[model samples]
Target: MKLGKSVNFTTILLLMFNMLLTSCGKNDDGSGPSPIPEPGDGVVYLPVVVHVVHNGEGLGEGPNLSEQQILRQIEILNEDYRRKLGTRGFNDHPDGGDAQIEFVLAKKTPDGEQTNGINRIDASQENVPDLGYNQNHYAQYAYWNPEAYINIWTTPLPESSMCLALGNATGPKTDLPGTEHLSIPGPNDADGIMINWIHFGESNIDCHARFGRTLTHEMGHFLGLLHTWGSGDCETNDYCDDTPPVDEHVYGNVPFVGCAGEEVMIGNYMNYSHDEVMNIFTNDQIQRMHYVLKHHPGRNALLTSPAL
Candidate 1:
């Protein structure tokens, strides 16, 4: 079945970029963390478990990410979520409030065997190409409890240049069997996260920069962050009012200059460029994430559970 007007992928890319560049200039300094809508008391803290599957290829040029590399990446996410990137100027908003989400590599396999939470599956499955999808057996063998654990599968990304991250949502079928596939390369509600190995290498100014943030970016999608440019119009906002309206998408590596005197936030994580300048989430982005956790079907329960 055709998916709408088959938004020309290129067009969608440009549109997202333009919107980001144009909105970069607006800076209402002191745009603090969004007020928590739900009471801070009963809110639950979610634990995250990552299932890192690799092709045995090194991090940049060759070999899979060493255990150290994997751990480092996870640390980055933890830091980003905690609003602490080490350096004060590392993030644009400066107010990178805590995401309230935490990830710890699982120590026990689903079968209760000792595990680093990093499952090293032989990257040799016909259906599971180099791009990913070999996680079925891992999740099956490990047996994800579904309600308790969120499995994040990491694998060498496909050489395909067009698609960076692919996310699947279970919608109302969160309880369906195979929901874990959305996180791995499986079919059901797996909620898989895919990242290109190239993003960890030297970045090209003409193309988006290479950074482990691809995983971070895709994770945002898994958490339900719409492109920062807002799908369309200011009304189509990323569900955040602080983010400015973007008309065009950023392409190649051009530093987005703010439009109409607004301070350009080329550093926003949702933009297309690979610049390190875009790191913080607007208060609205944070709210949207919280909104998903509180209102989305399986998310809240899963997040609040200890199995995560």
Candidate 2:
């Protein structure tokens, strides 16, 4: 079912205003999220379906990564989200939070048939410049009900683009009013993360983003976390109080201090920093994600639906 545009717009504005007010308060030291949520709730499990699209390449070749590689990516996601001890980037920060979200590969299809959650498709539309269009085209080859499962498309992205991004995603549409039409089912339901195959797993390719943190970054977007700098300037907040506000994205290993002279959270998962240095989501980010999963339309169904 579609949402009324007017009602949706009003609701989103109200929610965003409330979030802004709630997140504006800072501690005496100028640290964020004045009052963080106490961690005691049960974990939220999300079923996942990975679509590996390749250019007629056989398994374990090109974009068609091995099943083991995909599993490794899932393991990385679990470690990042759950903050498992001994994981590469896990650390102890008072504001750093464990999202308490677990992602499991689907064991059953939408038709109730037992199968691995991985879908390998021999298609040539693997590399595209426009991520939204690419997801729509690839979904025609293989797609399940998006409401019940988190769909991740792994393919090669165009290397020639002037501005290269390891991955991109369509955040929850409920937050964008006029864009509700984009969520319609069929070939246009662009509601998942699209990652460059080379950046999918830790060992798939050797690049600056080889540590599998690209997916971690995109997953933050998928779960409604914006860049620490927000959409534009320091004035534009990401609705998280704990994160220091920067003027723009800080790429590579360059040290960045916030616009207001606060120490930037260079290691935040939402930043464009190198994978090895990117970790930790603030308490407010965790709260925002939990709110989306429980309150956003179509998203809430995943918590209860058995299909994937």
| Strongest candidate by TM-score | 2
Candidate models: Cα lDDT each: 0.52, 0.75
Candidate 2 lDDT, 1-308, residue by residue in tens: 34466677778788879867866776767577444222236687788899888877778876888998999999999899988889965868888988898888998889898868998887765443443545676666677887888888886555453136577777775463222322234445557877888888786344568888888888887777777777656775576878887877778766667778887887888888877887788888898888778667667777765853
Q: Write the per-residue lDDT of candidate 1 for residues 259-296, one digit (tens) a residue.
A: 34454456566666453554666666675666666665
What TM-score does structure 2 among the candidates reach? 0.77
Off by over 4 Å in 2: 1-40, 124-133, 157-163, 174-188, 204-206
Give candidate 1 regions above 4 Å deviation: 1-45, 55-63, 88-96, 125-146, 157-189, 200-208, 251-263, 304-308
Candidate 1: lDDT over CA atoms?
A: 0.52
Q: Superposing all C-alpha atoms, what RMSD in Å does each candidate have to the true structure?
A: 20.8, 15.8
